[model samples]
Target: MVFTKKKIWFSSVALFILVYSINFMGYRDYFPLFLLPVLGILMIRSKLSKWFLITQIVLLAFLVCYCLMALYYGYFSFFAILGRLIYPSMFMLIGYYVAGFDTPKNLKSFSILILLITGSTLYGMFSLIKTINLYGSYENVMSALGGRLIEDLWGNSYISATVLNSSVSLGLSLLGLLFIKSNDLAPNKRILKIAILSIFLASIYTSATLGNRTGIITVIVSFFTIFLLKLNSNIKGIIRLIVFIISLYILKLLFFNLNTFGVRSYWESSFIFSRFENSKVYDDPRYEAWTTIIRNFNENLLGGRQINLSVNFAHNLWLDVFYDAGIFPLIFLVIFTIISLISLFKLLKLELPNIYKGLVIGLYTAFFLTFAVEPILQGFVVYFTFFCFLIGIIQRKLTSATY
Candidate 1:
């Protein structure tokens, strides 16, 4: 195949996603930086969207101003803060560069994303089992896996993983299932879906092992949303639903029933289960952060205060926008997000393949769940950039069809 501009764009973006998804040795953190030269070239060649350009300009302005304020106040070093902001600020560019094309048209187009989802999931499972073997107790395992002490809004302390946020990666991985067809992976599509579903099921176990409820819930939401959106009253759909639920249950049983080497009891006693077992699940600290930020919005209307001093971030995407760059950028982002979501819903109704539609639905819900509580725009740059790139494709398709 000739490496046309479109192909180059797809390959680079796909490779970026794959590298970040696998996250081997923390390369995920810096891979985007390394891709700057290539992406910059593509950006120059691509016809940028007006909406994207305006939004990027406004966001960049706010970021510069915010960093200046942080610097003057001795909150942090100016260069360090600005350097960190660089990757996140590239989201608009990522979106605009790929907006001219459709979503990947063939399996080859989606291969890297597939490898990302399946490979990361398998790696997560392996990490969980390895942790178990290395540390016999739940507490020991969690601490060994880079967990740190965190207190909830209610002052309940538990160990939460600090090094890696597995939920986002896993949630993003679930989107790969959207590209799969019944006939693609196995003897039939049904078995293929089930096989991938099984990998994700074990990922739930991995989440539980790490005491990551968000990861667990996001996986369930992804599965449920994709199926629910595709649900019709037809008999075949009903049968698939039944089989899906049954398969999920059976998969769950198989994972937990592994009695060899006391793994079953080990899983049962893990921090995730123990939290629920003791009814200590409602320990959210986001409420406090949200309230404080909202109340202080007037104080920081022109420029945000240093959020790192309090909760590292506002803990909500919109609130983080409000808290980090003030109301102007917040308003722009909110309007942009609303429009993007409308585009997503519109894309779902179009005459695309079920795989693409499911990808749209699954990724939207999964990311929404994460974006609501976590500071995705600033904190999860790689995932946010990929999301922007995908949404850009949606916007592009919608615009092209209007003509």
Candidate 2:
């Protein structure tokens, strides 16, 4: 396919996969810096649609949230709210690119593009094992992997792996649907199959934080949706699901630790908040910050904003909203999200291609979990791209007149 200016216009929304795909090379490095121009490109050419209009309204509502924050707390706190959007907005641009790939043939082409990225992830895991570098406890993990800490990819034990997990899980789950549809894939197709399995296993073996759980759960939800909706129609799906369950159980025994720190912590931190809010641990500061947010919201629920919220996102996405903006924008965000979800659920009823349905279901589940965990992660890139794909798929359904 030639690089046409029209198609390339949506490259910005492709920002989520591209940024994280590069991050597999270096987390918190120069790649994020390069995303700026790509995002700027999106700003220029992104055409307006219902999805686009909704997102803009949501953001505008959030700005009102910021106003409430400023008036109540007398602190202009919009940047914190804006910061959450940086990555998500970039991802929304990718949806525009997907919009162009609306046909079955184009879907196949786009699937290849996704696989190419997943392929790099397989290589990254091997590179990690070959040249691992460990610091502190990571050194111990490397010893466990039998490569000193040198097997540590990018000097971070799980960062690269976790990001790849998100990309590969979404990519492979989508591809699996396609593969199941055909008995005669190309000669090189086996490599893609290997890549999918390898990345899936790697994601399980790699130690993960709370973020991993969201992706894991998302994949499960997506596949199950596919299974219920399509697997019953094909015997291969039953076999694939049995293998998947067995594999995840086996990996859980080898890797998944239920007692890990942040990953283990429940959303309700009341007891911890009571005890540690009085102690010097980071938990102590969280209450103060949370308190700061609530107080501000009460003062100006309409026009508020938060600035320079301390390190590592506020954990609770809704709380982050109350802390940064205010309540009303939060309401708008909720409504916007509800509408998109309803749109997809409606699509699932149509007798569309299982491959397309699986991809959409899996991504929707994953991003929903992500939203519960992280505020900014639930932004434009993920939602926009996802819905745009749905829109394209929906267009096909329209011609079918499948209500």
Candidate 3:
């Protein structure tokens, strides 16, 4: 059947909502299994390049072998296994299909969809905060919210959950809003734009609410990187930097001095603050997990091995790939990332809208930061798959001559 733009639009939005809801509801390993037929339809309609297809096939082949091993070892059920396979495949197909939508109409539609998704995520964050206020601690909050609680080896409590794909979605959505400027809007509509922007900006505090330092850091770093790229002269850059520092200082003073709503104490009692107070920057369970995985490298060098739930995967994307699918798949992962990054760099040099450029930088930082620390491939595939979708956008921009 021939696919019209309207059909593609509906399908894309439907797929997006389905995937996001599955993740948001914490049904990653169960609900997504049923989406294979939908994903199969997407695969049939998606037009991927030879390289993405080849690399995806090789990567999936290794993952398939790994999944079989998992099954043989009774690590997960068949349905869960199917869900695992479908998540990455579905995102890749959707990425390919959506990335080619570079027209103004498509961008506007995507902006609306992203706004709705981000708004929903904000609501979830608010709910989480309210729950925390009522409970006073994240312990046993998993039932109320949809996240699991964990106490580390150091006797510290953490609620390692987010409204969307672990705050990466929030950060990227904000960046997308920043980049996709609606400059032509009438003056009367500017207030609405500013209000939306304000809501999103305030949502950064939601990172603290979720105790997600990575999210906060990625957003800050991405903004700084974008700011640096926009600088045309050293003097102007320095002036801007000084102004930014002054503004931050003023905000800091206002923040610390105010205790009107008792929000400061709540923030301090939040998970992110607790982490900063209790742990050093390098002091994390992931470091030990990485060392242990490497120490037992030979055990997972072939068909890989089962992962422990306590520490999750290796918490490093490449190491997890090596530990789960063995050395061959790890090599392919490196190849895939390198190719995407190279293309991203090439896209950066092209004359494009500042919004897309900011997205490229912000997404790059967010993806890398998460990949370095999170079990993205196994537990948070939505984040990485979304990164793949951004890569598809980058590829489209690079191939387009009219931009």
Candidate 4:
């Protein structure tokens, strides 16, 4: 089969969707292995922009420096370093194609992909319902099913049915809502638009049910940021905003009234005063992890210590960078993040469509929030790749003389 540009593009998008959507299951841990061939294909066929290439080179150089230092320290493991590099490297490749190829079409495809993900998550929620019905409690259901479950400070169980996948779904739903709001649909297309909106609402509810504070906060922040930024100026925007608020209120009431499987009460409790009062204790582990990493820092602050440490990551991106690769790499990562934010802000200032701006904001907010709770650049492959893709898109737009 002839692999034309269009074919390659579609194939890449399909692979992305497959990897991203199936993450609701437990298979995402091996996604990097499956993504290897796709990355190779993308590297060979995709066109790269100058800035994107430069960014990759800098990251590659840093990785090489870090690896050599680890080797000298007798902690070098080829596969270990390779595993760490896979997602970010793949992200660069994703960004390359996303920037140089058909962007608008790819964006549309991504919108559809997210809708599919929302549907899959809803299915998972329903499955959880079934499990609860059978087992009489979330804990009993998880015990029977046997998977990771996180309990919040209140002893309320939160299922990792979708794990980190909820973060991506939340970002997508925000972007999808913005897209739907900004676009004018034909009478025939209104149903489809409504369906997408309903799915977005459901995705938010599911994120809340999953009990990932970061994911829930990301969705809320992204929605309001996009809403205030794009919709505050117009009367129609205000009406839409009111409608959105009412819809959310109604959804919350429905969930509260139904109170199925204790999910509603658990979610509601997450927002109550006691949750905030006990937040410091709830965040104690993360704080202790950071303290441990800092206390264990070796003398070589430039090249970092060996990767053989028992506690590998710090859970926070900045602290993790410092712990894993030392102060130099930490500085580099911070600079990169600052530059990405500046670029995104510049892109937002451009006279682009409201939908495009909203998409950028959604991606930016999600990535930023993830850094606080997840070592996204280190382990969360989907989100890391998505962040890099958004960066690539922003870079492409900023550098293009036409825009």
Candidate 5:
């Protein structure tokens, strides 16, 4: 059956929403298991570029070599090695299929769908918050809300906020960038757009209230990145952005005092004040992990150490990959990242719609920033999958434009 491009795009969007919703509902394992076969079928039907095919071949080759090394050394179980390969493979296949049907409108639609899913998850978080009393401490509130506060090896506590919070923050930040860059909306739709923007901003505020530092950081960094990227070309635009940022800070201070919004206290307690106080005591786990990995380099230079060598994640993507799969796979990952960034940079230079470009930049930067704090590539497979799909869509657009 020949499906129109619109039909295919809509189908892909629906599937994405379904998978994300299931993920938010705490069925991440089962949903991906079910979704992979469907994505494989879509990939089989999609026409892919030669470069994409070559890239996949290289990635697969690296995975094969890594798996063989792991088996040879008994470093990881068969099931463990297979699990590591599955997500990236799923990302490549689903990304190819979605890219085949990508269009500016489809991208916008998919982004809005993500926002809606984020809204649902935010509502769930709020419901949990409501069950706790006003006097509850942050730890108590977060404990009631689900997700644990883990202590690193050095005895520093870290909030491992739920995936839903991170996803909501990511969606809200991207949606904000899209809204700010979109100048072509109908004049009559101004109020509607403002309402939607307000909702997204409120969700961001909710993320802060829930002690999800990553979400708050993503929103701040994304907006700053978009402002600089979109406005740096003109003197007036630069001046306007500066004034806008100043005014925003002033307003934030005023609201912070009034506590008119629930966001201020939490933001102050969780991020601003706590971060400063903890700075003297908190030795970042990522730094420690990287140090340990380097110290053990000779032991795991070609083949990784046995899985029993460490019970904790490396907490940095590059370090994690290097520790788990050895130097060859780490080299392959670095090469893949460099190539993807070059392609994305070229796409950014194109005459695409501002909102589309902003979305790509925002998502890419946010995802990359996450690698410094978590082994996102290994654990947050769903987010990584979406990032890969966006990469593929951007590549497809660039290819079409060149032709």
Candidate 6:
């Protein structure tokens, strides 16, 4: 029995490392993505705890409701909810990985993750450059050719806001450099961190698209939060936070009007707010979405009616959930989020470096804002899986009296 558990443990770890190495290369499709969960479950005895089982059943109930709605509406053919399950089903295996292993040092783990990001970005940039040289601007680039080229070369969408959000938030490499500088690690480690951050920053700017500015600004805020959080909670620390907030206020004064402000976007004419004074169309899509959830409350309480409501994406995740599931899912979501945050915050008693705390806190902070406008439920599995595992890591550390 002991030998068997040992083999499962080691094999599962090996599988995780192998799958993680493939990283961006195999992220987009089922075979590679599904590999993790399948291996994870096989190694772990094919049984999750009753807690997870019950949770799955709950989600299953939601699924049945959705399927019934789909059958009623005649849109259940593609097996969408079932198909989408393919993504999380893969990561659920990873959750078992977290359940078993301790969190390794932040340095190597995050370095591997960021390295994949930097590599993918470079691949995308090179592809873009080649396409431009061969076919010129977007006007000349054919969608079929461009898509084939994007998938073949980069594996995922380069300009996706959620993808860019992770790379750009606190600058993956930049925070890595801060880790090196703060920690008394060897000189080579320090240099590696700095070098990685430099490449990451350049790539983020190159990948800039519509909402890039707000994302960059959020990164700055989160980065500053990290630096300040590191300072002892003395008068000096409070002053630093104060200064940071003021700077953010100024930035908001300048730009928040353009993109979304808590699930709402101002008219594109924010610069000329005066010109559109009377055109009060506060009716953002979120309101309509919210109404949908409210209306469906009696029939579909646990989540939305599992029908094929979204042909593609909700475009806005927060509003979509609120609309589909009513006010309760948001409440459940917020509570679960608070649990994650509070758990991590207590783990901070371990006094993790400002760099790591900043990295975790900043990324969560950035995602909090980003998800307001986009559903990252479909983003780099690397991001979602890594974060989930980190939570498990922190919980384990706290429980083991590591502090």
TM-scores, each model vs. reference: 0.71, 0.56, 0.74, 0.68, 0.75, 0.61
- Report lDDT (Cα) of residue 251, candidate 4: 76
Q: How do these models rank on TM-score, best leading?
A: 5, 3, 1, 4, 6, 2
Residue 122 error, candidate 1, Å: 6.0
Off by over 4 Å in 6: 1-27, 31-83, 86-108, 112-180, 184-187, 207-211, 238-314, 322-335, 378-386, 401-403
Off by over 4 Å in 1: 1-13, 49-84, 89-112, 115-138, 143-163, 166-169, 172-195, 232-268, 277-283, 295-297, 300-313, 377-379, 399-403
CA shift of 180, model 6, Å? 7.6
Candidate 1 lDDT by residue in tens digits, 1-403: 6889768867777666565655655455566677678668867876666755655565566556655555555555554565545755564465544445444344332244344555556545554455555567547754654553322112222323422344334444364464345442234566556655675676666665567656767766777777766664678878888997898778767766656567688768667766556654244567677877776667877555644334677667778767766777667667667766877877776666566566667767766766777776455545555556556556555555442
TM-score of 5: 0.75
Is candidate 2 or 5 superior in lDDT?
Answer: 5
User: Candidate 2's error at 168, in angstroms?
Assistant: 7.2
Worst lDDT 10-window in candidate 2: 376-385
lDDT of 6 by residue, 187-260 (tens): 36656666666755655554442224445456555566566566657987688669867987877766664444
Give one digit per residue, the lDDT tens place, for model 5 in 1-403.
8899778766765665554543444444445566766776767776677767766766676667666776776756666666556766666665555555545444443344344445444543544344333426556654654544322112222324444454454555555454463554223346546655665666565565555556667777877776667784899988888898799888877887667676677656664357445654247555666777777776776755533334377776777777767888778877777767887788778766565667667767667767656765455545555555555666566666642
Give stretches of model 5 more than 4 Å off.
Answer: 1-9, 24-26, 32-45, 65-83, 103-138, 141-165, 175-206, 252-272, 280-282, 303-311
lDDT of 3: 0.60
Evaluated with TM-score, which candidate comes out highest?
A: 5
Candidate 3 residue-wise lDDT, 1-403, digit = tens: 9999777776665565545633444443455456568668866876666656765675466557656655665656677666556566565555555556556433432343354345445544555565566667666565655564432212223435632335424443354335335443323336545654664565565555556767767767777777766663589877977897799878766775684367677778777888678877667788878878777777777644544434757788888877767777676677778877787778778766555565567657767877887776566555665665556555555555255
Error of 6 at 272 (Å): 17
List model 2 lDDT by residue over 1-403, tens digit each. 8878745644543553454553455553234446687657755785456655565456455545544554456543345334333433343444443544455333443453354345444444544444433333434554565532333344444433333334433443443343444223333556645655565565434313212344445555656765666666678868877887898787665554553344334423433333333555345444455566665556645433443445434544566665545567668667656666766777677655555565566556655554454443322223323333444434334334332
User: Better model by TM-score, 3 or 5?
Assistant: 5
Roughly what TM-score does model 6 have, to 2 decimal places? 0.61
